[model samples]
Target: MSAPRLRVAPSPTGDPHVGTAYMSLFNLGFVRRHGGAFVLRIEDTDRARFRADSEQQIYDTLRWLGLTWDEGPDVGGPYAPYRQSERLATYRPFVDRLLADGHAYHCWCSPERLAQMRERQRADKQPTGYDRLCLGKSEAERRALGGFADTPVVRMLIPDDVPLTFTDVIRGEVSAPRPDDQVILKADGFPTYHLAVVVDDHLMQITHVVRGEEWISSTPKHLLLYRWLGLPAPAFAHMPLLRNADKSKISKRKNPAARLTWFVEQGYLPEALLNFLGLLGYSQPDGSEIFDFAQFSADFEWSRVNTVGPVFDLDKLDWLNGHYIRELDLAEFAGRLTAFAGDPAHADVIAAAAPLVQERVATLREGLDMIGFLLVDEASFAVDEAAAAKHLGEAGQEVIAAAVLALQADGEWAHEAIEAALRGALVDGLGLKPRQAFGPVR
Candidate 1:
């Protein structure tokens, strides 16, 4: 068999979503396993909602996770113009051909008329869709209708008697009733997602269409377009959507876990984040969760993917991150924490304190809090009131005073020497136990 070509098409509308990374992980894993080509296509057709800076954020975030693509807008490939906005001319020709062949018609219905149509449908308890009022109108008649704009939008014709059926790699054989005639091209002359995606996927030679299960309803619409255009459809695999603890679909507006940048900013290791996402709807054959990205790519299989939605548990992610944090060597761990610290003034202190708190922190951001006392000015440093109240009473002050005297006399300031001095002053010199003596000074 020939090598497959898979692509992840993300819309640059807002903050890069965790769902985008989830889909990319699976697509990249599949491509790596088969030695196939992975592509990144920017679906920036929604001009009204698009943000200019969002495109670069998507690229940066994906690369941070080490999910590199073979072809993208940044690096030109066999298929140049990876962005949909750049390929506008390519879609117009296909739309014109469909119109000329009678497979689609111009829709001249005004906004008011369409709104009233939906209102009437709601009142009559009928399915809400375009009534196809202008489906049979001619060119001259459409031009005579001065109530609307200069030109009409294009809509694909859906056969009422034809039942649509397609087998999904994850959902198995699925069937749906014939859908209403969908608008393929908007009034603004921009093709809708249904038309644009079908055209671009065929042109890009994408062998598989892997996306979230939310797109399953629109699969039939896409299938009809492939048939109308006389183009072979690619294989479809709709993965389960990520859910919150409450079982609601994950949304960036409501859930922080939905944003990819949230994890990065929170100091989550890229390897750990990717490993956690990989196990959401898929698992290893050995049922281990502490594997690296390369191991995941080697063991990834479509048959092992679960169809049920997976919950985005924050606590579970923290546990996974803690495991990865502990596995790093001392030098590498100190380097990662130092980068997160973002302060050269504390370089010597951070290198000294990192090994002391390596096992106590799950994230590098958490390390900042754990060692805050060592970095702050003496005037700014303050002990926790509750902890001081519990351990630093009048009697506790004497133990700390003795610890200070012992440390001042120590010849060496090394870790072992400091440790031995504290132990002699607190545990041996004083009759009090180690916990009791250290509690006051700690």
Candidate 2:
């Protein structure tokens, strides 16, 4: 048999979340390792929040990480028109079929009614989804409620008391309370994500449903849909959530690295970023830690990845980045560093400082700070606390002034010589111990 078909479907919205990259890397690695086709599906059905720029970002970010898809919007595959929005015509037939089979019914419940229903359920300490209010509506009543009205949505009637079960690849043997009924199609006539995801997964022949652990609760719902549609449920592997260092949900609002753009701006190598993300929930089965893309793929046995939320330690990631950076040849490093540097005023200093900071830094911003002295026009440079104490005090002021004058007299304008001259003045001329003199400068 051909390798199992796998995919990463991401929603196009505002900023590209690190979560998207994390999930993409996992799927890409898994599919590639098994010699399966990896597909990219764009789920942009939520037209209100849809952004045109998001598509390009998705393509750019994934390609930047060297995660190429066998099929996508930009590339051809068996699943042509690989976007959910373009497949609305396909969805309508399934909705109609569900209604005709009596597996689903017309839901004419209004939002006001839903709110009231939720309140009643809350008072009774019961669950608060739809109450299937329109399930019992007469044919005449259903006809009356029809004709471009917002109330006539389509809902699947879920059977009660049949304990639905599916073996999860991560959290095994998952189940949930089968709902009385579910809205397969909203009043606006758009399919809900639950309906769309299941329908598409079946249609796409996706073998593995690799996703985050939060979706573990929803697995039963998907399982119900599969059975109702008379289709086999795909194997699932719900990987752990990537968390903040504080163990909270990883959020883009709170963390810069949570957004991929920040990492791109900071000049993080895409491969390094991918490797760091992989380390979040997985490690070598034999206990090896250092992993590149190929190594990660070689060791990606789904059973080895954790089910608990993995802490996104940027410090740990920085260490990984250092490893990736060291592995890169200087020419390759220089090319990448140039891209993120863009049009900075002091590109020369940055170029010079790149190698020096290469061994010690995690980000290009850190390297910029190392060459800061070259870029800083000291004529206009104001005194920060250290600069004030080190150069502005009575003794410090005289020494700095003398040093500046002496340095100005025979200056080859260079950072190293300038630093050496300043040190000589402080230690030799000022009669200050090196530690005492450099302490304030530092």
Candidate 3:
């Protein structure tokens, strides 16, 4: 078989989501192991929502996590202009052909009429979609009417009551035939994901389509598109959804989406985050926690990938990060810290946190956390103001001042000295135990 070509196409809008990383890692792994090529494509067809630097950010975020693709919009390939916006001219002909062949039709009904029909249908327990207002019109008739007046959208003809079956690498024998004939091209002259993805994947030689379970229900529409276009369909592999601790799919507000920036800011090693994502739905035979891309690529098996969703457990990630951190030598850790410390805004934070973070910090990856306190530039910390108020009562304040002063007297500034002085302040000044003094500060 030819090397399995796979593409990871993400819509650029906001922060780089972990879903993008998860799918990209899988694609990169599959292609690398099989000597196939990995392609990066940006689906920025939504002009209004398209961000200026978002495509660049996708590249930056993925590369930060050590995930790289062979061909991309930035890095040109045989199939140049990987951005879908640049490919609209390519999709226009296909849309016209589908319309002429009766495989698709122009929908002229306004949204209000369409919504009223859908509401009535929903009120009567029926599927609500386009009522095919202009499906019967011939090409000449549509042209005579000033081309449907609204720039015309192309929708596939989804026949009723026919089952569509496609094999999933993880879940075999899956079928969802006769899905609602979804729109292939919008009136804005941009191809919908359904059309753009199908056409690009075929043109780019994508052999496998590995994505989250969320797209499983929509596979029929894609499969139907392949059949209608008479093109070979890529093998499908729906990696299970990632869940939070409560068994719900991971979300940004509820849980950190394991974004690349989040991992970088948290001081997590790229290798560690890569390993964590690698093991999420796929793991080694002996349950090894840390694996490099080479080891993972050597062992990758699509068949063993889990169908049951996995949880994005922060505690587990912390443990994994700490493990990678400990594996680093003191010099390497300090180098990483220095890189972040070089940031002028974060410099003071690391300076203040230097004594506190010495051996206690699990990852230099957390340089942002060390400097997070400085963001409040008030005479004191604000967000963590409650931190001071919660523990630093009037008497506690006296002990802290005394301790800071006690250490100030000695020119040798060290954590051991500061800690010893603080301990003395707790016992001699506040008459509190060492734990009691530090407990409130924490």
Candidate 4:
């Protein structure tokens, strides 16, 4: 069989979501294991919520996590225009075919009318969906009846016997709730996700569709489009959602960690973040919690995926990040610290202090904090007032005077000799405990 093709289509609507990375990891992992192409498609058809800069953030954050795609908007492939917005012309033909075949029809129902319909459905405890108000009506007939819009949106004419069950790569046979007449194309001429995704995946030859379990409900709609358009459907694997401590689905609006950029800004190593994400829904055959992407790809299988939603445990992430941080050599660690600090002038200081904090911090931000005092000039440095009050009393002043005299008298300038002299002066001569002696100086 030809190598499979897969893609992660992320909407550029807001901050690049961690869910995007989660889906990308699985998509790219499967491709890497099976020797296939992994594509990145931008689903930017939602004009109302779309942001121009968000597309670039998606590219940047994914790359930052060390995730790459064989084809994307930035890296052109046989599928040249990878973005949904750019391929508007490509979908029109499919939409026309669906309409011509009686599989879909134009709906002139206005937004307000639909809202009121949903409101009534809620009041009546009914399953809310499109009412098919303008199913067979012309624009003139619908306008005359009122509650009509000037431009009509196309809706799929879902049959009563439309299949509600489909095969999932991970979950075996899964059944979804019966769907209503879903809108396929908006009045603005932009195809909705159902139509655009079906068209793109079929054209791009995506062999597998990997996404969060939240999309399982929408699978029937996509499957219907594939069947109606006479296109082969890709294999579906709906990975479990990442949940919060309370088992609620993680969302960027509720948790900053759900934003991919939050991990970067917090100085998490990409390898660590990738490894953490991998462990969320999968485990290595060896039963290890920590493994890099290469190992993950090598051992990936749809069957091994855990369907239960995994809690977003940050303590595990921090532990993994600390492990990765400690694995770095001193020079490399210092270099990363310098880059993350975004201060070239502090390169030497950070390098000198890297050894002191490399094993002490779980993140570059923490490393910087651990050695922040060393980075500032003496003029700008100020002692913490609370610490000063606790350690700068009369007894502490006496220890400092003795430590100064001992340092001045010692000829050797090495750390060991200086430490010995201070210990002898404060710990022995002054008879103060080590903590008492070191408190003020530190």
Candidate 5:
């Protein structure tokens, strides 16, 4: 069998979503397992909500997470013009073919008329969908009848026998409700997602469609388009959606973690973040919670995917991140800490303190926080008065004095030597507990 082709298409509407990485992880994992191509298509057709910088953010965040694609807007592939907005001309031919074949028709109903139609349908307790008012009507006839727009939008004419069930690679047989005559092309000359995705996936030779389960309802519409256009449908695998602690669908509007950039900004290791996402709807064969991407790709299987939506557990992520941080060698951890601190000048200070804090922090941000005082100048440093008052009584003063004297007598500059000297003076010599001796100094 030939290698499969898969793509992760994300709309450049806002912050790159964590869903984008989640989908990409599975898509790329399958591709890696079968030696196929993983493509990144930017679905930027939603012009009203599209941000000028969002496409770049998608690239930046995905790359930050180590989810690199073989073909994308930045990296040209066999399928050039990876963005939907750039391929406007390519969709017109398919739309025209659908129209010519009696599979789709143009609707002149304006937004006001469609809204009124939906309002009437809701008032009468009917299934809300286009009423097919413009079907079989000429442009002039529709204009004469009443509400009509100058520009016409294309819609699919759903056949009575439209299949409502399809096989999902992950969920076995899945069924969706009968679809309405969905708009294939808007008056703005942009194709809707239903039309654009079908055309692009077919043309790009994508063999697998991996996305969130929320799209299950829309699968029938896409399958209809594929059948109507005489295009071979790809294997579909709808991954479970990520849910919040309350089991609500995770969204950028309500949850900051839904945004992919949040993980990067929080100083999470990309490997750890990637692994965390992998564990969301999948489990390793060895039943281990912690594993790298290479191991994940090697063991990728659609059958292993859990259909139930996984709750986004941040505490688990923190534990995994801490494990990864501790696994890093001191030199690499120090470098990462300096970079994440966003201050190149603090490299030496962070390096000097890396060993002391490497095992102490779960994230680079926390590591930096632990040594933040050392980064500031002498004048800028201020001890917490409450903390000092609590720990610096007479006994604390004695411990400090003994530590100073012992260090001054034979203090070695090395870590072990300094620790041994301080412990010997404060813990062994002064008969004070280790925490008692170190609490005030720290």
Candidate 6:
């Protein structure tokens, strides 16, 4: 078999989503392992939802996560015009061909009509979709309806009630009931996902279609389009959807974790976030969870991928990020902390205090809190209310006083001197236990 060619087509709708990163991880793994090409296509045909700058955000975030595509709108390839919006003219001839061959027909039904049709279908307990009202209308009937000024949307025909079966790389053989004829082209002259993806995948020779499980029901429609167009369909692998702790769909509106930029902004290392995503649906041969991306690509297997959805467990990710943080050399770690801090004023103090909390912080952003006590102005530094309430009683105050006297008399202003003074004053001098002695200071 030829090397698998995979593509991730993200709609330029909003801030790049973590789901986009998830799908891209799997797609990148497959293509990289097989020495194949990974393509990036922009599905911007949804004009109302499209943001002009969103496409760049998608590219930027994915690259930040180290998920690179060989060919994309930013980089031209054998299949030029990678963006669906740019390929508008390309879809017209295909739509015309489908129409001439009786594989699709024009539907002049307005939004109101379709809504009413779906409402009536719901009322009658029937499938909700286009009623194919324009299928066999005579010229006079169409003229009476609105003449050509209506600019009807094009709907592809679903031949018969046959089961559409496809072997999924991750889910094994899957079959779904053939769906109703779907709109291939909108009245605005833009092709729907079903039509655009089919054409682009076929033309780009995408050997594998790696996407979210939400698209499973729609796969049969895509399969039908490929059949009608006489184009070979790519292998399908629907990765399990990422869900919140409550088992609900992860949404940007409801969950900040759904936004990929949030992770980056939160100071999550790209490698660590990618590693977290890698383990969500796929795991290593040894069942380890901390491998880097290169190691992951080396051992990626479709058979090992899980069908059951994985939770976007932030705690687990924190633990993983901490592991990566500790693994970094001190210099690199300090450099990373500096970049994440994004404040020049804190640079020197952070550098000096880096080693103190290098072993404590999970994310670089957490460095601010871990070392804030050192760099924050004494006037502005307030004891955490919760900690103070728990530890700032009479005994805690005595412990603090004893440590201060010890440090005041100590001639050397060095690490060991400070440590010994603190221990002598608190741990050895005070009857309190180590945690008790340090509670107030901590």
Model 6: CA > 4 A from native: 138-149, 373-403, 423-439
Worst 10 residues of 6 by lDDT: 140-149
| Range of the 10 consecutive residues with the lowest summed lDDT in candidate 1 | 142-151
Report model 5's TM-score to 2 decimal places.
0.89
TM-scores for all candidates: the values are 0.88, 0.87, 0.86, 0.92, 0.89, 0.90
CA lDDT of each candidate? 0.89, 0.77, 0.77, 0.92, 0.93, 0.86
Kindly list the per-residue Cα lDDT of model 3 for residues 253-277, writing each as its tens digit: 6665555577766667788888888
142-209: candidate 6 lDDT, tens digit per residue: 75864243778888887776458878888988887668888999989999998999988998888889
lDDT of 2 by residue, 362-410 (tens): 8766665655566668797665777576656786666657566657768
Clashes of each: 0, 0, 6, 0, 0, 0
At residue 200, candidate 6 shows an lDDT of 86
> Cα lDDT for residue 3, model 5?
97
TM-score of 6: 0.90
Q: Quickly count the clashes in candidate 3.
A: 6
lDDT of 1 at 108: 82
In angstroms, give how far residue 16 of model 2 lies from its true place: 1.8
- Candidate 4: worst 10 consecutive residues by lDDT? 402-411
Query: How displaced is residue 69 in candidate 4, in Å?
Result: 1.1
Per-residue C-alpha lDDT of model 5 across residues 38-93, encoded as one tens digit per residue: 99999989999999999999999999888899999999999989999999999999
Clashes in model 2: which pairs?
Answer: none
Q: Which candidate, 1 or 3, has the higher lDDT?
A: 1
lDDT, candidate 6, at 150: 72
* Candidate 4 TM-score over all chains jointly: 0.92
